[model samples]
Target: MSVRDLNLPQREPSRGELPSRVTIWEVGPRDGLQNEQTVVGLGTKLEFLDRLAAAGLGTLEATSFVHPKWVPQLADADDLLAKLDRRENVRYPVLVPNERGLDRALALGVESIAIFGSATETFARKNLNRSFDEQFAMFEPVVRRARHEGLEVRAYLSMCFGDPWEGAVAVDQVVTAGRRLLDMGCFQLSLGDTIGVATPGHVEAVLGAFDDVTRLAVHFHDTYGQALSNTLAALRAGVTTVDSSAGGLGGCPYAKAATGNLATEDLVWMLDGLGIDHGVDLDALVRTSAWMAQQLGRPSPSRVVKALTGG
Candidate 1:
């Protein structure tokens, strides 16, 4: 599949914040805490997720079903899902790597699930130990089965702008993989700046290539202080779905230098200022991130949190 092959519907130019409501997909629990070096207990993970939920975030990525041998920190995926707070109107999505992982998620009656892929060949092989095409081939049946079971499937495409080893990635490559994921039954596609090198201009260019903004999500890392800028650019490009971590607590395990994701606190502050409705309470978000920072025994990397809390 190619960018031209997507046959996406024509879209009008964006008017910033035209869509008053945006979905802030919180990834602090699964993507954020997974990169922590120390073992964060199951109770702590649950507490962190519950705090985020109480802060008014509706969609939360709870955990990953990746093998314990790989991501040991998230080894409690099953246990966490088993006892997670089932709050009304709150969604708990988990990441599943393959059929086996999907099976586990299904057993728990997971409402939503996410599968990850890479735009570049090198990162795909490095992360999933498979070629680019093989990666989706691996996710194909898993996504189908999960959707068939009435689960909302999200396709996560990483390294959308710059690959650590591959340098600049072609926009068409991203479109191709994203279209394939959507074609394979994914209801949403979250394009990620895995190494955090995407700038605002690149964000606009890439997002412009996608004709349908409703099904698109943007995930950016703050390695170079560009996450918020890139996020605003995506918003200006008509994207209403944004992925962020609370307290900025995540990094790419495959790319050693990949830093924390865009902090949900930072995004909420911007959205609040712009009069955009994210449904998140900035004060509560700050409080939750502050508490999470304490749990980690480190200052939060979020500038907004720092400015607000003097950490």
Candidate 2:
């Protein structure tokens, strides 16, 4: 199938050379739907996961193990995991907010877990109720133990670009936090533009700081409409993993200005044009996003989905 076959807006990479193939970490389940106001049915969430895997996304962030008081929408994480008809050759990673969350994930024998640490002080205080350094200290034991127990750990560093309270953040600060997390046993680090303020230049500078760009993943929110462009910038800089939410569903409860994440359908459309083998079926992805949109009773916000579905 070609880009025209999928009704995607044809565009070429505006920057440097691109990777031959990229790995997309689908975060629709945890990062995207968690911010939704309505309580999505457990069966609906399960079906969404199945459809995404069928669409060829191998790595899916399933659910967050945070306490119900924090994210009530995902209180069914346990039930969702237990009742899920697990698919082979597809990974379901869950978010662990703290040591207690790790305990819950351990009970389920989770293979991969992601923990978040913020780059700015204000977000750290608001999200974790701790100082910037304090949050790392808290994550240290959790990461160490989880790694020791044989689990693939991913670390997310939020607010790598501009911050609402602190204005523009320095690239050095992001690298420092990312390096700390990597040294602490996180196999891969995801740099998050939590407020969706990152530009292409910032993407290059941050990825340039890392010794090995392959160990880093770029997670961009679409609030500023820079996610795709910034992802291209990361690819130009040698980063291969891109994190996106299906149907563009996302927001940050802690970050007041955070909006939706970059939609997987849109990302795949661009990757299709770039000839980057992401292993995603555009039609299946659009159908899956459309199905989820119907379940939510709202149109999918992805441009590609809207164009293909004629929404």
Candidate 3:
């Protein structure tokens, strides 16, 4: 489907909702720690998630169920899910790449799973080792099976704005892929600026192409220092959810220059300044980031952490 085919009305929010409050889905435990050089024990991962929940984060990406050969870091997906302290208001989502991953997640009684696809064929091939069509076909059964098992499904479309191998992705391609996932019963779709090259304009253009039936979330990296700006653009466009990491953890291993996901502490600071309610304890969250940084043997990339703790 083309951008024009989307047929969405431009309903700009009134002054009261100019800078709307957004739901921050913390991906620190899974996406953040998975890329760390030092392997964090399963117990530590659980503790980190517990602190994140205590800090008032309602949604957390708990782990990925990929094969051990592909991502050895998340090989403990079953153990992580089994030991999770499932709260009444919080959701713990795991990434499931295919039927095998889905079976493992389902076996562990996971209620929600995220499946990913790439906007560009090149990225799809490199990231999933399949063509766009092949990857979609692979995930279709996973989504259908999850729905049958009464599980909520989320779709992540990476490299929505640009790709390392293929530059300047068309807005239509992103919309098309997004619509397909939504049509397949994905509860939400996360549009990812995988290489962190997106700007505010790109955010607007991409979001403008989607209809209201599909809930949207923004995932950005800080490679070019555009993550926060792009997030603001998405918020202005009425996006209600965002994906971020604690202490700015997890840069793309595939993209050399890409930075980490947007820092949760920094995002909270911005939300607080706008009088947006995130319910997260900024001080505690900062300390959590510091703790993670110490574990990783690196300085926390969150500006709020550096400023608050004098790191």
Candidate 4:
């Protein structure tokens, strides 16, 4: 199936209407805490997510259903999923790295799951010990099974801009991967700036290559201080979904010098200033980030947190 097959109606843009109301998927619980050196308790993790939901975050990445041997930090994925105080309107998406991960998520009665693929062959081989086709093949059965069970799927394409081993990724490769995910019935496709090496120009160029059926989202790292700028660029290109961590908490363990993701508080501040209705409370969000930072025994990375808390 292709975008042409979807038969989605085309609409001309009107001046008053914004490109689209962006959906901010908070990745704090899963991505943020996953990289912590110290293991956070299950109770603490649940509390953090509770606060996030109270602060009006509608979409949250709750946990990753990968094997404990692979990601020990998320070893309690099933426990967390079982204990979560499920919100009717809020979506809790868990990361499923392969078919086994997907099965675990399904066993926990998860309705939504995220599958990831890398754009560059080197990154895929390095990270997953598989080539691009192999990784995609691993995802295919999981996607099919999930769809059979009526689960919503989100596909993450990592290293969309640049790879640690390969400098620049071709835009056509990204488009092809994104199209493949969409064809596999993924509800959304998140293009990740894995090493945070993306520029606004690169964002526009990458997004311009995709057709309309594939809804686009962005996941940016703040490594070179380009996350926010790239985010604004994504918005300008009509991207309606953005992924960020609460206090800029997580980074790629594979890539050296890679900073945490773009901070959620900072993103909300920008969106609020732009008169964008994100339905999130900045003050509460700042408080949540501060609490998480205290638990981790580290200073908060969010600029808005510092400014708001007088740190």
Q: How does model 2 score by TM-score?
A: 0.95
Q: 16 in model 4: Cα distance from truth in Å? A: 7.4
On lDDT, the stronger of 1 and 2 is 2
- Mind giving the per-residue lDDT tens digits that candidate 3 earns over 1-311? 11123453334345745444578999988878777766788988888899888888999999998777767788788888888888889999999999999888888989989998888899889889999888889889999999999999999999898888888899999999888888898989999898899999989988988887229999999999999999888887888798999889987766667789999988887766565667788778888888878777789988878988997
What is the Å distance of residue 240 in model 4 from its true position?
0.7
Superposing all C-alpha atoms, what RMSD in Å does each candidate have to the true structure? 7.6, 2.1, 7.3, 7.4
lDDT of 1: 0.88
Poorest 10 consecutive residues by lDDT, candidate 2: 8-17
lDDT of 4 by residue, 1-311 (tens): 11123454444344444453668999989888877878899999999999999999999999998778767888998889999999879999999988888878878999989998899899889778889889888889999999999999999999999988878899999998888888998889999999999999999899989886238899999988999999988887788789999988998766766889999998887776565667787778889999988889989999888887888
**Largest lDDT belongs to which candidate?**
2
lDDT of 1 by residue, 195-263 (tens): 999999999889888878789999999999999999988888788999999988899899988999999
lDDT per residue (tens digit) for residues 18-112 in model 2: 78889999999999988999889999999999999999999999999987888898999999988877789899999998999999899987899
Q: Candidate 2 clashing pairs?
A: none
Q: List, in order, the clash count of every candidate structure.
A: 0, 0, 0, 0
Could you tell me the TM-score of candidate 3? 0.93
| Position 40, candidate 3: lDDT | 86
lDDT computed for candidate 3? 0.85
Error of 4 at 136 (Å): 1.0
lDDT of each: 0.88, 0.90, 0.85, 0.86
Top model number, TM-score:
2
